[model samples]
Target: MGFDSFAMVDWSSGNDTGPRPRKDAIWACVVRQGKADEGPTYFRNRELAEQWLLDLITTEIEAERRLCLGFDFPFGYPKGFARALTGSDDPLGLWEWFEHRIEDSPKANNRFDLAGEINCRFGGKGPFWFNGLKRKINGLPKTKADYHSPFPERRSVELAPEAKGSFSCWQMGGAGAVGGQMMTGLPVLTRLRRTFAGKVAVWPFEVLDTPVAFVEIWPSLTLGAAPEGRIKDAWQVEQVALSLAGMPIQDLARHLNVSAAEEGWILGVSQRKPNIAPPPLRNDCFALPAGVNWTPVDEALGLLRERLTVVTAAESLPVMQVSGRILADDVFAKRSNPPQPNTAVDGYGFAGAAPEGAQVMPLCDGRAAAGIPFDGVVPGGHALRVLTGAALPAGVDTVILEEDVTVQDNHIAFHGPLKQGANTRRAGEDVAEGDLVLTAGRRLTPADLALLSATGVADVPVRKTLRVAVLSTGDELIEPGGTANPGQIYDANRPMLIALMDRMGFQPVDLGRVPDDRETLRDRLNSAAKQADVIVTSGGASAGDEDHVSALLREAGAMQEWRIALKPGRPLALGMWEGVPVFGLPGNPVAAMVCTLIFARPALGLMAGEGWQEPQGFDLPAAFEKRKKPGRREYLRARVRNGRAEVFASEGSGRISGLSWAEGLVEIEDGARHIKPGDLVRFIPYSSFGL
Candidate 1:
């Protein structure tokens, strides 16, 4: 018989409000291997919940596996919340509180008036010595009655301090601290844990103190696209339950229907010359396909840490550091903007000295600003008038302000002597002969272009724009430009998906809509792969008959991974067609966009030389109520206000309006079936994904 390694309990606090039970209060226990048909059970009280949890452990789990029972509540509470509420600096205030409240008698050494005394007393060594009797009682349950000790047991109920030993009380803060305020799920979980020891193990989310582990799953079918019995898919709950039963990694991957190597093949065709005879089919056109693994989103990304490289080399690009993105490379300056020395202000440039009290006459050398400059310099006490940013003439050393010099004759006299090199602009100060402005791999901006133009540069060396091909699938879909027939829907995916590619720095080639035709798909894919670096087609990536994109992928090229175990975009396909990466996205607009943000975006980042391109997630309070199915993760459309996040009420993957109303997305993984309002949930802004 196998050890009953899985323990489950439906947990919840009786005082829960805010329109939903706490997520930690409900538990789904797996007694043995194989998928559990039932979902999580709800509990109204801790006593009833703990009673049922203990029974499950005793009956279903074998003695050896009994210790692996996982409660759906928090095991270790945070130490901070108690300090914040009780105004006690000591870390053990809550723990001491437990000791005082649960003790056999209220007068049992009323030193600190600890809270969980009855709970911590069991952790002590000796039988909470009744009078002078010396006995041992370590494993007794918190609810156990008076000691069962035999010989010479006294009637006095006072607990000896020595019996307590070094058992220093500590507060179980964490989520329980939040629960302390609302008395939601934390206390119920605590009561359950204290009721049973050594029969359960609590595993928590990476940073959470609660024992619930969030698992995200992907699938091959949409929520309601296909009938119930027809859906063939695996969920995250199945993985977690099976893995906890001690399934090996390789076996688990295989059980999840993932392949470790490439076992298929693909072909490509070259362009033909016009008026030339058709060439015979060649053997070189066919080759063995590349092997790619279909894995969970987390697992798939975890493997690329050591195997990926970023490319950023291009020709004729300007100096990338100073100019930002290089508009063009190896390009030369057209001509100097200011062909001569230029003045920086409106003043007079004169040579030599002026006569005493000799009023200088104002003579126009010329009007010079940025584009125009004075041709000749002032010679022999002659003055050349200059303006701000105007080129100063040759041989003029001093410039006097027009207001300071009183003009009476053909010459000008300064009320005060002019300072040399004052207010004069020099030629070549902005740029000298042949200078590097921008370099390759630099993204060009308006400011960069201005600097280059100022330096006498034009027509820069920019890398040829990366050509990207975008296409949409699904027989039920109709082009937005055309009239919609009965039972057909207009296509918002093409435009929305194309806009995503555009913002990501791609020159998009809209391939229009592709019906569920294999031959047409094969031809279009072959052509697009040759012309574009990436081919993005939304819809029809599933295994259904109407979902023909995967089949067309095999006909056009080799596919690496198909159907990642993720929600929203589970039926995603990653393949190489004619040397270009082709992404077969889910047909639903939301799924297509999400898949692009998650899988396609990262893959594009890899192609475009970015080290990483993942969205930044922040933990915020939930503003609205939301419920989720266990075992599958979801990106709930949500809006954040005043540091709190509230998911949209109509957060269905097929709903487009929800996406529009959401300011960001809340990512809820497995183990978290429902999020209560005000709970801190992780969210990513729409702008972060370049939306």
Candidate 2:
């Protein structure tokens, strides 16, 4: 169903929390009872305002009416802010970063102090000015003259191409300055994401079509053009709501298609055109902070290898038992494969090089069976019968095959002369003494064991197996094979990752599901860390995550790294928890699988002491066509049909079956996104990855 009700939150600028009603706390306007011309109901504080909003949403749901929620603050800053603070370009990256940095409650918060600290990180005393406190806050400017900002005064969204006259987010406690509101506003967004995760669709970040969708809006855009005599705030809300209600569905769709991932879009910015589909991401927005560069697939693979320290601890195992395990040390041949020269083929062994053509040699008295070599030295001009693996007797330097000579009356006749080394296997022919055989960090295969056995290496050293713990977080998830309620799905990521790790030879410890509760998830993850060398979690890793596993990692002083330039798995989170490395994958089943294989798999290998082993991919022709943007790398789930790469029909990452349907992934390079039929793309087989 389309949106049936509209709501807006006019956030307050007050910094104090008191039991008494706040004069400028938070005000909410809702189009209740399907009446778009209705005025707003004032809320005195954030606590009451949010509760009332939730109640309105619940009421709408009961009546089976979809709702559209709008808030006045910017959803995010311009691009570089995310890269500087969180090493990622995802807008939610900023949200989670802010979540950890800000401390807030219903009564009072450190919004001004937090702004000052943020300004310092970007170059102190200027980016954030306007200290709204009774006393001076260190580093925060008391007057406009003291402002010294390291960055530009306004963001890209506040300048040309977007909306003009939008104030800087760095302004705190000043007229028209949204800095304080944003500091508090983001936390509210996070809480809402957590509270109404499954039901609410956050536009531009998540695809719309859920029961309710929330977008960032500017009241000034509409209120500035309000009719005369409608200058009141409540009256403005009523008129804006009525104007929005009059818009056709198709018109809203055009506005929904906006180019504002980091900085959100205005709700009614496309009424005239009403079908303003977003253009391809322009190049100007790609400019990120210095030292923060896009990581290509090969470079990412190299980085992973650089981080994986070769396993130092080694254990000795019998050469036969070491198969399927990685070597921890280099192995040398104890002795050559052949201690003495032997015949490489069934032939006659002569004592010395034969004369030029038609030489006659007396046949040996005893044939040289493989195990029973002739004991007596051959007489001059004589030959001995030899087999493929039979040892050559003393003074035997060449072999004449039976097919090349005729034996009659205990003598052999030859038409052609024999060379000294013809048909003769020299000593150490396969391997020389003390030669390097198998190197450390090489996984033991059947062939490796055979080589070790042939060289007489009795034992080999290998590293211990790495322990990996897995968990899936979300309230809308249930264990696979269990009955699911409406809007619930099975926990595919946990099991999928567990299997992926197993294929790579790591010991996967299943820690199971964690509900959308912060404390419970933290406890469970901490416990998993103790039992595992590496921990993996799927879901609750996104910026919009209600139970934000990424935020918890930040809270625990974890060193989280992410914002990789990869498609389908951009939301991946990597960090260390309680000394154990953790990989937090996106909740989408396909994204979880892709991130695990492309990113987590290598990191896990490093923790296990395995040096870089990149999954092999080969170039193949594309059977379908696709157009993608530049900068980010893309991997399309594809299968080989008619010897050509065919991607899955649907591009949605949530489709788990696509992973199963795919035989491999077709990798498009960082900048090359356009694909035509017969175009060569890198295809990485699932088998090559041991999947």
* Candidate models: Cα lDDT each: 0.51, 0.73
Candidate 1 residue-wise lDDT, 264-325, digit = tens? 00001111225467555556311112332235567545433322333333445443333333
Clash count per candidate: 64, 3
In the predicted model 2, the residue pairs found to clash are: 17-107, 126-148, 194-546
How far in Å is the alpha carbon of 126 misplaced in model 2? 38
TM-score of each: 0.45, 0.57
* Per-residue error (Å), model 1, residue 31: 42
- Per-residue alpha-carbon lDDT of candidate 2 for residues 1-691, written as tens digits (9 for 90 to 100): 2578877777765644355533354656676433542466666566676678778778877788888887777777755677777888788768877877777766677888877777678666667788988887777887678677765666555665336667777778867668888877777677767787788877768877787877777766534333233334454455445435434344456567766666555554442335477655647433444445555556555544543344335799898787767788889999897867888889788866776888877787887767888887877677888888888888687888879888889888987765678988888988988999988778788999889998889988888787789999999998779999999998878878888888888888999898889889978987887787778898877556584787776443233344567778866666545545568888888888888888877677666666665789888889999998887888889999888899999988777789989999998878857789998988999987766
Write down the TM-score for model 1. Answer: 0.45
Q: Kindly report the root-mean-square deviation of model 1 from the true structure over all alpha carbons.
A: 25.1
User: Where does candidate 2 stray beyond 4 Å?
Assistant: 1-312
Which prediction has the highest TM-score against the true structure? 2
